[model samples]
Target: MASKLSTTPGEILREGQLEKRSDSLLQLWKKKRGVLTDDRLRLFSRSSERAKELRFHSILKVDCVEHTRKHVYFTIVTIDYKEIDFRCTEESCWNAFITLALIEYQNRRALEGFRRHRLLPIAYEEQEESEEPRSPSP
Candidate 1:
């Protein structure tokens, strides 16, 4: 198993086993333990290899499938129609963490966009503003 470094430079929020359901068998599930950072969620395999990564920007939304007394099942859907499901203990509150991370990421992106727009000059608007008004002919 090969170990890969995280692409995003952010603090890790949570790291533990998250049960992922099998596509073919609803009864079968797999345990993955990995780091959930501010920008992405990475799942590692038994051999300590990076198995999957879901970035905040790629995720459209997170949904709670079912919440029993002990466990909460949730799914994260990406923009490209990819669905990743996980079951965690109720206390973990993985759904909330994911949502908050996404919100923070979006806010950061919006701020960056605003800053970029400020740096760019509007040529047409500037030309209009610089031109002096002419007097009407009699």
Candidate 2:
């Protein structure tokens, strides 16, 4: 999936049907149209109504919990430690796509932070040096 990773944010990475465990006491599995983007996973109902969104920034990790003859189950753990369950066909690889997109997004954020940190010290030193009195021009 790395080879297909889009550098542009908000681009659709993958789209397919995914079964998510509902929140009610019955915990029924509902089919959702899962749209994986560079930034978030948007789940829509059969009628095309927006259901739930799992944003990468809020997602802690995606865990593959179980596998059966026909489907693969996974859980998305959020930063607040809430776990959401989902399942899809093994061939669809929805879990893998979401995990890869999240990792790529996180890596990009870390790289940007590192770049900013590396430049900040140099910038600060330049400012300090300029503020210091010049030694009589050589």
In order, candidate lDDTs are 0.77, 0.90
Q: Give the TM-score of candidate 1.
A: 0.74
Candidate 1 lDDT by residue in tens digits, 47-135 = 76756888888988889899999999999899998888888889877777777777777777888898778755676578777896977
Which segments of candidate 1 are over 4 A away from where they belong? 1-8, 122-138
Residues 32-121, candidate 2: write the lDDT tens digits.
Answer: 999898889999999768567888999999999999999999999999999999999999999999988888889988988998999999
Position 13, candidate 2: lDDT: 84
Clashing pairs in 2: none
Q: What is candidate 1's CA lDDT for residue 54?
A: 81
Per-model TM-score versus the true fold: 0.74, 0.90
- On lDDT, the candidate that comes out on top is 2
- lDDT for residue 114 in candidate 2, whole number 0-100: 97
Model 2 ranges with Cα > 4 A deviation: 4-6
Instruction: Kindly provide the TM-score of model 2 when superposed on the true structure, using C-alpha atoms.
Output: 0.90
| Location of the lowest summed lDDT over 10 successive residues in candidate 2 | 1-10
Worst 10 residues of 1 by lDDT: 1-10
